[model samples]
Target: MSGWTAHLPVLPVVLPLIAGAAIVLIDDGKRPLRALLAVLATLAQLGVALWLAGIAGGLLHSPWGSEIGVYAAGNWAAPFGIVLVVDRLSALLLVLTAALGLMTLLYSLARWDRAGVNFLPLFQFLLMGLNGAFLTGDLFNLFVFFEVLLAASYGLLLHGSGAARVRAGLHYIAVNLVASLLFLLGAALIYGVTGTLNLADIARKLPALTGADRSLFDIGAVLLGIVFLVKAAAWPLNFWLTPAYSSAAAPVAGVFALMTKVGVYALLRMGTLFEPGGRPPLFGGDWLFYGGLATIATGAAGMLAAQQLGRLAGHAVIVSSGTLLAAIGLLGNQYTPSMLLYLCSSVLATGAFFMLIEMVERNRSYGADLLAVSFEAFGLADPDDPTGPDDVVGIAIPAAMAFLGLSFVMCALLITGLPPLSGFVAKFGLIAAALEGAAGLTPVGSWVLIAALLLSGLAGLIALTRNGIRVFWSNARSTPRLQVAEAGPVAALLLLCVALAALAGPAMDYLQGTAATLHAPERYINAVLQAEGVGR
Candidate 1:
C-alpha cells in the first residue's frame, strides 16, 4: 500500500469526523443534499472497513504485514503520541458498525431523519466515535470516543421528542454520566501508576509493578471493569437499557445495538492485554462467570414477561451481552472463535429485530382490541380498550404483516439459538467447545453455562411466540402500508444473517484468526509500538 492507503487505520475515524463537521454546516432545508452526503460518507466508510478487514485477514497486504495496521497521529512515536491500531478484531467490528450505520441511515431516510435537526450530522459523529473507540490505542482516546458516541446517542434518543423518550433519555444520560466519571477516575489511577496512557505501554509496565502500586492498579482496573459492565448491561446495572432502547425511534434503536458490544470489546482487550502471564488469576474471572449467569437469568425473565415487542428486543440485547461475558469468564481460547461468531449473529439479529418492531407494532390496535374483547368475555373490561366496535369478519392481513411476521420469526430463531440458523451454529459451537475442555471450565461451571444457554433459548422462544401471535395472528383494524425504504433494510439485514449461516465455515475461519490475535496481544502491542515513523 502506498500514499493514502497506508493510513487506512486512521481513515475510518478521520473520514467520519470530517464528514460530520461538513454536514453540520449544510442547510437543514436541504434534506436531500444532506441525506445524499451522509449516505456517500457511510458508503466510503464501508469500503474502508472492508479494505482493512481484507488486509488483516491477509487477503490484502502492506509493508506492515497482514496481521495489524497502525497509524501514528502526526508521525509521533508510541507511549507519547496518539495512535490508532487496527487488527482483525477491530477491523471486524468497524465493518459491523459501518454496515449497521449504512442500513439504519437508509431506513431513516424513509421518515425518521425528518424527526429531528442534525440527524445526519449526529449519525456521522456517532460513526466517528465508534470507529475511533475501536481503533484508538490509548485509554484517554477511548474515553474521548466514548463521550463522543454517548453525546450523539443522547440526541438520537430524544430525536422524536416524546414524554417516554425524554424520560428514558434522561435515565440513559444519567447512568452513562456516572460511567464516564468512573472511566476518568480509573484512567487517572492507571496513568498515575503506569506513567503512560497508551494501552501497549500500560501492558508493558503492568508486569513490573510491585507492592501497593499493583494493588492500587488492580482497584483502578476493577473500577474500569465495573464501568464496562454497566455499559454491557450486566445484571443489576442494566435496568435502564430496555426502557431507553424501547423508547427510541426504530433507526436509532437499531444502530444502538452495537453500543453494548463496545463494552465487551473493551473487556476483551483489557483482559487479554493485561493478563499476568504466570501469576495467579485476576479478580474478574469469577465475577464475569456468576455475573453473566445472573444477567442471563434477568434477561430471560424480562423477555418472558415483556408485553411490548420493543422491551423484548431490549432484553434480547441483555441476553447477548450475558452470553459473551460468560464465554469470556470461561477463559478458553477454543471458545473465543465461536463466541465471536455468536456475537456477530446476535448483533445483526437484534438490530433487525428493533427495526422490525416498528413495522410490527404499527397495526397493534387490532390485536389489542381482540385482547380487550377476550377479557370482556371473561367479565374483565380493559380500560385502555373500552367498548370499541365489534370485530369485523374476513379481515385480511397485509403483505407487510406477512413480511414482518417472517422477519420476526427469523429474529426469534436467531436470538433463541434455535436450529438451522446462524444462531444455532454459534451456540452449538460454544457448547461443543466448552464440553471439550477448550476453556477448561470446571464441571459445575460447564453444566451451569449449558443449562443457561438452553434455558435462555427456551425463554426467548416462548416470548417471541406470544409476541408473533399477538402481532400477526390477531385481528388488526388495518394493515400498515410498508415503505420500500423501511422494508428493504430489514430484508437486507435478515438476508445477511442467512448468508452468515450459509457461509459459516469461512466466517469461523476469519473469526478464529481474530480470536487468536486477541488472545496473543503481543502481536497487537508490537504493531502499535513499532510503527515509529511509518505512515507519516
Candidate 2:
C-alpha cells in the first residue's frame, strides 16, 4: 500500500474528528455552516470507507496475504503502537457504519439536530467512535473506541430531552457501563492468561497455553462474549435495548442499528482469534446457537406484541441479531457468504425502517392503537377509522399516501423476509446453507434453526402487516410534510437494499470470500504481526 491509499484506513477516524471540532468552532446560530461541515466530513468518511473496501475486497482475492493497509501509529510495531487494520470484515463494516451514519445525519438535519446544543458535534463524535471501533485491531483500542462511542451515544439518545428519552437514556447508560466493566474484566483475564493484547499476537500465543491457563483463557473468552451478547441485545441481556432505542430521536435510533452489530463484529472477530491453528471456533459451537434461537423467538414475539412503530423496529433489530448469532454458531469456519450477505441486507433495511417509522407516525393521533382496538372489540365502525385496524386489508389509498404506503410496504417485505427483495434472497440463502449441514452442526440442529427462522419471519409478517394496515389502510391519514433531506436518506438506504438483491451474485462472491478469509486466521495474524511500519 502506497500513496493516498495507504492512509485510507485512518481517514474514517480523522475526518469525523476534524469535522466535529470545526462544527464546534462555528457559532450555534450558523446552522447551515455547521450542517455543511458535518455532512462534508461524513461524506468524506464514506468515500474513504468505499475506497478501503475496494482495496480490501480486491486484496481478498490476491494470491498474496490479505492486509490492505495496516497503520502503525507513531511508527511503532505490533504490541507497542496503536494499529488500525483494514481487512475484509472491518472494511465491510466501515462502509456500513459510514453509509448508515450519512443517512441518519441527513435525517437529523431535518429537525433532530436543532433539538439540543452540540447535537452536530456529538453526532460526528459518534461517527468517529463507530469508525474507530470497526478499524481498531486490538482489544485495548477496542475498549477505547467503545467508550468514545458510548459517550457520544449518551448525549445523542437524549437529544430531544423528553421524559421517555431521559428515562431510556439513563437505562441505556447503566447497562452499557456494566458491559464496559465486563469488557475490562474480560480483557484483564485474557491478558493475564495470554500475555498479550494485540489480536494477532494473541492468536499466535493462544496455541501455546496449557492446563489452568487454558481454562482461564476460556473463562475470559466467555466473559468477553457475554459483553458482546449484551451489546448485541441477545435475549435476557437485552432488556435495555428496546425502550432506549425506540425512545431516541428518529435519526438517533436509525443510526443505532449499527450499534448492535458492533457486538456481533467483536464476537465474530474474537471467536476465531482464540481458536488458533484450525481448531473449530472456540465459542461458535457452544451456547451461541441455542441462545440465538431464544433471542429470535423473543424478538419475534415482541414484534407481534408491539403496537408502537418504534418499538416494533427495535424488536426487529433483536430478531436480526438472533438470526446472525445463530448462523455464527452453526456456520463458523464453514464460511457461508450467505450469512454475510444477510447481515448487510438486514442492517440496511432495519435502519431504513427505523427512520421511516418516525415519519409514518409523525402525524398520528395519540391513542390511535387503543381506539382501534376498542372499535374492533365491539365491532363498531368508529368515525375516526373508516376501515377499522382489524378490518381486512382492501382499502383504496389516496394518491397523497402513496409514497409512505409503498415505503412502508417495502419495509414490511424486508422485515418479514418476503419475496422480491434482498431479505428474501438473504434468508433463502441462509436456509439453503443450513440444510446442507456443516461440521459441528447436526442435521436436526440445522432443521431446528430453519424452523426458528421461518417462524420468526412469519411472526414479523403478521406484525408488520397488521402495522401497515393500521397505519395506512384502517386509519384516515394525510401526508406529513417531508423534506428532501429526510426522504432522500431513507430512499437511498432502501435503494441500496434493492441493489443488493439485483446484484446478488457478485455480492455473494465478495461476501463468500470474506467468510473464507475470516475462517483462516493465519493470514490475519501474519499480516498484523509482520507488517512493515513507518521508517522501516
Candidate 3:
C-alpha cells in the first residue's frame, strides 16, 4: 500500500486531466493522434481502476482487514488539503466509470467525434470530472468537479447539432446550473457550521451540535439532498433526463448513463458519514420511500408510453434510479449488496441500450417511429425520403439486421429484468435480500418496493416487446451500416453484464463485503484523518 502503487488512487483523475489538457492544445485536424491519446488515457484509467479495485478487495480480506487508500493531493492531509480516498464503493464506481467511458469513446470514433471540434478533449475532461467526483473526499472539490463535468457535457450534448439536441442541451444546462448553485450554497452552509468540508472530518464533527447549528446544518443537508435527487433524476426534477439523454448522440447518451449514479453515490457516502451521529438520513423515512415509489411509477409509465427507442432507454434509466433510491430509502432495511449488484447491472444495460437505439433507429424511417408513437397519437420506400436517409451503406455478409435483432433482444431482456441475464439476477437478489432482512423495515415498506420493482419490470417488458415488434418485424427496411468500432463496444458492454450473471455468486460475495464495510464506517473516518501529510 505504500509503494509506487500508492499513487494508483490518484491516477484515475490525473491521467484524464493531463490527457484532456494535452489534447486541447493539439490541432483539431489531428484526429487520429487526438483520438489515440484519448483512448490511451481512458484505457489507462480502466487499468488503474481495476488495479485499485483489486487492492481494495485484497486489503479488505487481508490480515490488515482494511480496504482504504487515501492519496492526499499535493501531499496534503485531510481537513487542511485535498484528499482522494479509494475504498470499496469509490473503487467500484471508478472501474465502472472508466469501462463505460472507454466504450463511449470507441463508439464515437465511428464519426460522432468528427461532428465537432474538441470532441475528444471534451470527452476526456468529462471522464476527468467523473473520476474526480468519485475520488474526491471533500464537498468543495466535488462541486468543482461537478462543474467541470457539466461544462464538458454541455459540449457533448450539443455535439451533433439539431433542434432536438439544442433544445435538450439548453434545458440540461439550465437544470445543472441551478443544481450547481444549490450545491455551492449547501456546501458553504455545511462548512460554516462544521468548520470543515472533508467528508471524514465532517462525519467526526457532526456530533455534539446544539439547536440552531443543527437546524441550519439540517437545512443545508436537505438542499444538498435536493441537488442529488436532481442529479439522480428523481421524479419532478427528472424531466430533463428523458429529453437530454434521448436527444444526445449515441455515444454521449451512453456515457451519460453513469452520471445519475454520481448523485446516488454521494447520497450513500454521506448517509454513512452522517448516520453515526444519531441523525436520521436527510431523505429517509416514509417520505423518501414514497418518493422513490412515485419515481418508479413515473418511470414505468414513461416506459410504457415511449414511442421512440431513445426515449425508452431514457425511461429505463429512470427505472434504475428509482429502484436504487427506493432501496436506499427503505429506512431500516438497506439492501446494500443487492443494490450494488443492481447498480452495476442496470448501468451496463442502459448504456448499451442507448448506443444500440441509435443504430436501430438509423435503419428505419421517421414515419416508422411516428406510427409506433401513434399507438397513442402518431415506409420502406419511405427510406428515400430526404429526412429518412437512404444513402447509408448497409453492412454486408452476416447482415446488420441480424446483429440489431440480437442486440435489441438482449437489451430488452436485461432492461426488463427477464431471466438468464444479469438484470434478472440483480432483481432477484434485491427481492431475496429484502425478504431475508431482519424485518426491521415494516411489512408495508418491503412489499411496496417488491411490487414496484416487479411491476416496473413488467411495464418494461410490455413496452420493449411492442417496440421490438414494430421496429424489427412490422416494417421492411434497409439494415443499418455498422462498423466494427460501433458494434464492438455494444457487444462488450453486454458481455460484461453476461459475465456478471455467470459470476453472480462471487460478485455478490464482493458486494456483501462492500456492504458490511459501508455499514461500518469508523475505519473510513480514521484512515482519512490519520493519513500523513507531506514532510510529516
| Model 2, span 405-515: residue lDDT tens | 788888888887888899999899888777767666788888898899999999999999898888887646656546666777998999998999999998887787788
Q: lDDT (CA) for every model shown?
A: 0.85, 0.81, 0.83
Query: Candidate 3 residues 427-467, lDDT tens each?
Result: 89778867765344677767777899999999999999999
What TM-score should be assigned to candidate 2?
A: 0.91
The TM-scores, one per candidate, come to 0.92, 0.91, 0.92
Clashes of each: 2, 0, 1
Tell me the RMSD of model 1 versus the true structure: 6.5
Order of all candidates by lDDT, from best down to worst?
Answer: 1, 3, 2
Residue pairs whose backbone atoms clash in candidate 1: 332-439, 366-476
10 residues in a row with least lDDT, candidate 3: 371-380
Which of candidates 1 and 2 reaches a greater lDDT?
A: 1
Model 2 residue runs over 4 Å out of place are 59-67, 277-282, 333-335, 365-400
- Residue 255, model 3, lDDT: 96
